[model samples]
Target: MNAGFDVAVVGSGIVGLGAALAAHRRGLRVVVIERGSEASGASVRNFGHLCFTPQAGLARDFALTSRELWLGLALDAGVWLRESGTLVAARRDDEFAVLRDLAATRGVEVELLTAAEAEARMPLAPGTAVGGAFLPRDLQANPRQAVAALAAHLEREGVEFRRRTTVGAVRPGRVETSRGPIDVGRVIVAVNHDIDLLYPEVAERHGIVRCSLDMMRVAAELRMPLAAPLLTGWSLVRYGAFSATPAAAALRERLHSERPDLAALDLNQMYTRLPDGTLIVGDTHSRGATVAPFQAEFAFESMLDETRVLFGVDALRVVERWQGVYASGPDDFLIEEVEPGVHLASATTGIGMTTGLGLAEHVVAAFSDDVTTTADEPGFASAPTTTLQKGAS
Candidate 1:
């Protein structure tokens, strides 16, 4: 029972794994305890689109830090990553206005593309795009592979993983798991939406709840391969940076008035093509204390209809479909030390893959004196003792 670990992380998702990696790099003995046999949560059930360029405030800070960590993982851990910047296809002038406003603010980070240029870059139906913008700094990864590879790489670096072990309680210096008691210097809870189960008070205080989304993979014949992760006007109104633009209000109002059905679904219509050429399409949002297990078929049909209209393709063979759930809150993240020696870290939105690593690193660095932050790693500074407040990434 006495594992002699310096840090014990709960959950094996990206944030948990990132915590273990950060602690291990600081020469601390780390143990990860997961209730599942493997990581089968939101970590793997996402688009793997590192759309950090559209983030604002603290989320943007974490995103910049995550970019470096992701690039390092690609070289060190062999996690497959691409520098494929995000491509936003604007179907309406209002959407283009939002992108243009963002481009004005971000300069080189946001590159405005003409209608012809946008069509040339992506396999969109010719002339479908009035204009668009390319986020040159954003990246992409295979969600199915990145977390597993990172976990495996951590295991090779002397971190121990206790899979199928349920953690019942955590206190100042001890964690009570189903296996037994573990003595550790620190405890990090990164269980995403399940934090409610472990620490109801913390979840309640932050207004944390589950946000479920439906996503699918399909094999489709395109005019050409998807050059990068694609975002539609729906996406422009969802991400923080774009939504904060003055032009976003008109865009949102117009879209909602035009397509009440899609707006009813709370869609963030986006797509990312996997390395094998299968396109990952998603998704629709529904938030509650607990989401329904049943997914509506109409959601899938709507996605298919949108996909066909966007790409001008007739048929798409369905490969798979599933639901992805993540922590949702009023603010962008939930980083707190609810009790002495016990910390909570979670991305309270869909950008966990984009910002989770940096969030984890920031939390660990806050309390651990051994964590070294180089000059190049900006925004890795220790978090304030107060709660972090910002909009969604």
Candidate 2:
């Protein structure tokens, strides 16, 4: 079978869907090809915390754009979105210095809260915290539902989807899939960690590899009115916006001295309360060409222990545990023309939910402009024709 469209997206994750949506809005007929029946990759296996404040430099701008895009998509699709901000509490003096520095930034919307103020807003242990800052710009959503809803919304808007189909090769204006070929004006590959499957040379040249994370979800015995995601000193040392500051080194030293185990596991302790009252907590970072298939018990224990220490609670019950992998490179993202008429865009970091949509927009705009300029150039076709055949899951 052969399918014809103006734009063919090789992956149906958030990044691919974002590209399809942007192209469709520009009056381009788009079709998304997914290897699975649904989006079951890093898109759905994340915390779904749109932490814009923690993204520094150009990454921050993308986060802001993605925030707006997410809101509109959720509203249009009737998906549940929790406008829960993020509260990063400083547990140590060094961490306090970082928070204070961030609060002093003119354009940043972070409020430095005292220990008492922090406790008043959330159920934190009194007299045990040095300082904290609240970022009202952060947002949250149900990861399991948001991606699916976006795909469904795109489908409803007349974007075709070829689910359960693998893309085997990508050439100029054409995509050879396991089922057949898809002809298009342009092709966007948003396969993330699986980019090597279609462009192994590009992936190897960029030194791209998979970064794995261990995350856990637990049911809290008490339903506290937690308004936003919670972060501790560990997060300040992990998130780029805070960690890139001058005070981050001191905080890292303090953690390595006081909690060497956490440093070893690369743990960043944070928690977000879902609508169903379960807390989505995580995670430890581990990277390699391939990840091992196991979760260390101590990693889970360390997370729970940190949560207990931070909130003065010990009633958390583990409900689920899982691992997620994402494409990682030297930079926060990778967008390049791996082949003629084919553009590759990937959120090389784990913050795809935060910046995927914005990157997609950029890829679409750039590809569109390039295609128009080169419409008369060699090796470019402006027409297409095909018939579709449904594939088995």
Candidate 3:
């Protein structure tokens, strides 16, 4: 107990922090080792939107569950969450129908609106198109703030985080970091592409890779209208670029037929209003193994063009340009005991906000050798409350 840690987790990203929290809650002596000063990876990058809808199957469930946990954290840790609801504007009739179907699904409640109806609610400047579905449960937060707060909370729980420290080797019941060698009952690798950096054998056990793409944040508006996030038909079409299912394929075809301009633009994007009126828009492309470090300016521009065509916006001030790196390893959640004392987990399909907590719980249960005490609440665990107050992280 005085010598090393019960579990050593590599990577200080969202997943790593979630894992540390889960392990700590289960009463395991946990330590987190990060290669960055803060969460200097994809965890803190991109729009800090904890997406609520347009999610299906497992990711949707995990997202809902993570949101529940976030509510508790907001109450306890004072993490900020803007409770503005999401609106899916249906420029065309078919799109409106699709949203209707989405709402019809059990456990999903969506509010429909007409052009006049939506304008009154959203205050869209009269010509902001028409027809949309409003779901009030969607929420957004500052990713950096949330991560920092989580790190602090874990520290208070005696969970140690060694920022800028690298793991040299992973052996069963121990981890060798640049800081020093520490023995442990279990080791968890939460790093995405660089996971192999600590344990080369992890490459054979699990595919570790990066996802490169463009992200844009302008300095126009300083405040967001509502606390929720936004996505458009561009997303449904682009979802096909990543998935090959029949529904996805049909959706792609529909997008091509109804909105050929979107297909031509190569734009699969989701947009959210920043707190100040500037917008946060993104993203496309999912590289399975190794994502490149290039920004497709044309793709970004196309996203803007699609933005104009969809929302009919003339222009907004452009300030920030960004790139996001993500990890994915099929539908399977990653967790591998590489050797006697080494464990590996990464490539989580860009669902960090959704599945991180569930994954955390799973990791904790496994690490404790099946000793567990986590039960799901009736509805969602986290609900939209007041604006989250800014705290330490």
Candidate 4:
């Protein structure tokens, strides 16, 4: 079956969908091939926190571009999106220092809050925060709703979706699938961690691994509704903008020394309240070539305990528990040209929700002659192909 298309996206995940959207916008015949009937991957399993303010370097550039696309989706695709900026509660002096330092560098983008102000804005325990910061540029979406809505919107926009079809291989101008091979002008591989399965050499060359996360949703009574997606000191050490601060080193030391157990779990204590008011609490990271299906109960318990302490709640009714995985690599992204006319794209860290769309847009624009490059657009001047090399220090 030669259903010729100008572009073929190899996954229905956020990045893949973004590629399809970009190609479709350029008047290219686009087809999305998915192994499952729907998107059921890290795209849905995340906190839906679009923390764009904390990104640095190339990730920050992509985040800025993605922000515009996301806002457009809200108006065009009817995707549920909130302009609610990210809130960071700093319980300790070191945590406050990290926020303070970032504020100094970022100026209006990072607004520091007093203890009282922090408590009033965020649903933290009355006096749990010594200080905090609000990142006005961030956003929140319902992970369960966003991707599905985006997929639906793309389908309505004349993009062809071939769901329940497994992609066996991708060559220069063809995508071999479970159903049959399709002729494509270009191929965009955005399968996240599954890149290892489809293109083992590319995955290995980029030092890609699976980073599994433990997360849960619970119904809980709060001091007040969370003003936005909330981050804790545990988060300060993870994000590029916060972690790169001079004060972050001391903060990291204090956190690890105080709670080795949480450190061992690789915690990024954060919360996002869904529209239904259930709280999404997570998460802990563990990375390897392969992740264990058995999630440790202790990791969940630790998260629950931290949540109870942070919110000053005694009880929480557990709604769901699950594991989410993404592609983890040494760099912030994996953009490569495995072969001519076939591009590989993946957010190597947990920033896919923040940067995936822009990454896909840039990748597609690199090959599309119709797409014009703009001076203001970040990462659009040149294709990011072959940037991540194997064993490059």
TM-score of each: 0.96, 0.91, 0.82, 0.94
Candidate 4 lDDT, tens digit per residue, 188-298? 999999999998988898899999999999999998998799999999999888898899999999899989999999999999999999999999999999999999899
The stretch of ten residues in a row with the least summed lDDT in candidate 2 is 384-393
* Models ranked on lDDT: 1, 4, 2, 3
Cα-based lDDT for every prediction: 0.90, 0.80, 0.63, 0.88
Query: Judged by TM-score, which candidate is best?
Result: 1
- How do all the candidates rank in terms of TM-score, highest first? 1, 4, 2, 3
Q: Is candidate 2 or candidate 3 better by TM-score?
A: 2
Better of 1 and 4 by TM-score: 1
Candidate 4 segments whose C-alpha is farther than 4 A from its true place: 106-108, 373-393
Per-residue CA lDDT of candidate 2, range 1-393, in tens?
Answer: 465799999898889988987787767999999999999999998888889888875566567767777777766776568888898877778888988877776678898898778767776766667777889888988889898898898899899999999888889989888888888888999999998777888888888898888898988764356778888888887667887777888888988999898998888788888888888888888888887898888888888888787777878889999998889876777778877878998988778998888778767767564323233322212211111111110
Clashes of each: 0, 0, 26, 0
**Which structure among the candidates has the greatest lDDT?**
1
lDDT of 3 at 375: 64
Query: Any idea what lDDT model 1 has?
Result: 0.90
Every model: Cα RMSD to truth: 2.2, 7.9, 6.5, 3.2
**Candidate 3 C-alpha lDDT tens digits along 333-375:** 5555667556565535665664566555555555465343446
**What would the TM-score be for candidate 3 when compared with the true structure?**
0.82
